[model samples]
Target: MTAATQPRSVNSAAADDVAPIVQRLRETYARWTRRTPIEQMRDDWDELFRSRAQPWRINGFEAGGVAAEWIMAPDARANRTILYLHGGGFRMGSIDSHRDLMQRLSIAAGARVLGINYRLGPEHVFPAAVEDALSGYRWLLDSGVRSGSIAFAGDSAGGGLVLACMFAARAANLELPSAACLMSPWTDLAATGATFLSRADVDPLHQRPMILSMAKAYLGPSGNPLDPLASPLYGDLERLPPLLIQCGDCETILDDSVRLADRAAKAGVAAELEVYPSMIHVFQAYGELHAARQALASAGRFLGRYFTEQDKRPPEGRGDTRDCG
Candidate 1:
């Protein structure tokens, strides 16, 4: 093959390697969505997500006085911390289900990570998660961690909570964190995004019925999906910290990241969005995959930019940057 075609050929081979894994995941998602009970799903997740190796010295503690767990690598970086939120469509998910992902993130970012076990829906409802997220931030501040040294990160519904926390912090006049990173963020709880239908076939995990079900479970009869706190896509994004959003083109919520970046830019925040080809929602679950590993490393570097003391200048207008992988 000519030199010009070499890169394409290698990429093609790498993609082929990932195809079987994606197919297996898609099949598994379909099975779970069809037959799994909501309560049982938590246990199912615990069994499904097994860590290959432990990278952090894990411990449970009261973060800012709220029940939380901290995962720190052996040689952790100083003055850097990540407050992570786990995703389960607001109804499920816990620190246990997300430990592996958090461990990988801690290793990649070289920072201390706090995974807060926020209250879930069907019992706590809309503002409960919001309240917990804000409280976690408050605890972080009370613990003497400077806002500039911290970053907020999450996946799916937890990702939405990250944005909600930002809004809450801004309104409360709390100093904002240095940056934020969202993975396959379910920003629009209303399930109105075009990708919900367009990418339905490609995304094995989420479906219209399940998506709407989760929305109702979280919002209840009184909650409004358009409330910026609940659905951040409708929120004011002006003056927010720099944001990095990563999503797979095949995800049902792909537009959530896309429009979020656009809205953040229109409001003048430095936002970067990356759309990975042939990947599904939260593909970072497969740390073994080259694409997922690359995505996580990129995410680490993006958050690190803000954590670095020397790069704290105010972001400029319409930093609407996009990258493809």
Candidate 2:
């Protein structure tokens, strides 16, 4: 699990609303050294969102063969869609675990968000999640959703799946979506990013061994760690849709986003990278976090125009990459 180290500057101040949440998570995390039952985790995940009340129009339906739900903010556009993939290392997470985030993104992007309950690993392994995600995309296309009107967005492992879904879609000869936004994406399941060491003392949530164990569970015993679909950081990035990658300097997988943006640039893709100072994995999940709201707003502005073909896109590989915190 080694790779070339890249220089990343740090910013000391984390948003005031974020520190307490991170501290709580860190304390709670210290108690669980091993995986918890998926059912219990699922309940806990949903419970975190229960305290936040929002009037969202949620509808349940099947996307391809997978069970899913459409989360729409009151004024969300019906024509445009954001296919959201939830993240729990591909082993946990479902529509329930992610409704709050999905609802927020739907409003931010002003598009309906279709979130799927993709099969989890250790029970459903690699390609199963990928396949379910693709099925949701297929359902969108079949239902006459224009490719340009749809955007792909996800966080952590789900963020990686956003890229994997596009790759899978390209292979199936389907049209690519307008753009994508990844939040603290776990692009390298191979756990090779130098940040696994560099950010070790900073990121409170993840470590190399933990990531490797999650990867092994998702990939099964024989799956290749470098399989392009499983680890999009190792995949070919040529001719994919425009990308907006948001990462935090304090996260162990920060390098995954940095290197991903580099690969996207080298492959002639339009990529924007924003590194927030002193943030952690999926910090966007915390509604109270100001940086979280800012990141989602940035993603909204990036993907908003695409929903209506009003793309006043900045040129590829522009100077938008920076410490935006």
Candidate 3:
């Protein structure tokens, strides 16, 4: 078969092995959606995720009035760090909700991780989360973390926020992060991607209605759905930092990752897109899945490469070299 028409396969065996786990996840999500009210969903999610114990040493702090947490990793690079935003449609997720994932990310990237508890929807609404994200990143810079040495990362809605953050930072003339990694980013708030319907049956956690509802909640009634800060797919991606995107073929948001990668690459930015077969949204957070581990490791290698390159580059002309001392 020709390259374009060839049957693609990556980790098919592993996908088959994880089918049962994915099924359970699907069933659980179905139950959650059916029984939970929209207003209670955030606290419900917080309680559910908080109940799961994490094995990492985490500490709490504040950045620009935003609550944040740090997942400490041993043997971590002193200067390199990750600013992580959690995914929950910009409404539900919190620092505790993603600590396990943060711990794994810290260990994999060999860098400390700062998980930002950005304001959520149906409460703070549009621009609040994005503002909080920028504030956290600025706090990192102010606290001695060079932009060139830090990487920005997030999953789902958080992933989209990471891209939005990049755009805002670039516009402000601040030095961009060395790299960014996104997992199943919700880049299009318009819900216009073909996969939203084509892959609806396969996606375990999302449906178009729920996606639209979350987007509306986060964007507010008057907010523009295509606002670049709200939906990064509409933004100019030129000159942004190198990007790494991971998505599962089965996800409704798969096209978001694909399209973002295409846009970034077309705009002359270095980008890498990895699609996992038969996987669901943000599969990297599921510790039971092999693809999750593989994706994290790949992200780690990607981060390490950029970090090393940033270290070797000449300090002159790079605006990130301001002495923190």
Q: What's the count of clashing pairs in each model shown?
A: 0, 0, 0
Tens digit of per-residue lDDT, candidate 3, span 146-237: 88889999999999999999888888888999999998899999989989889998876788998998899899989998999999999999
**What lDDT does model 3 reach?**
0.81
Model 1 ranges with Cα > 4 A deviation: 1-13, 16-37, 53-55, 308-325
lDDT of 2 by residue, 1-325 (tens): 1122233333334544566887776655555535677666656656666556376545777878889887777677666688999998887777877888888888788777888899997789998999999999998888777798789999999999999999999999999998899988988888889899999998777899989989999999889989999999999899898898888888888889999988888888878888888778898888787787888887889888666543334322211112111
Ranking by lDDT: 3, 2, 1
Q: List candidate 2 stretches off by more than 4 Å.
A: 1-14, 30-36, 310-325
57: Cα error in model 2, Å: 3.4
Q: What's the true lDDT of residue 116 in model 2?
A: 89
lDDT of 1 by residue, 146-189 (tens): 89989999999999999999999999999999999999899998
Candidate 2 lDDT at 123 equals 84
lDDT of each: 0.79, 0.81, 0.81
Candidate 2 backbone overlaps, count:
0
Worst 10 residues of 2 by lDDT: 316-325
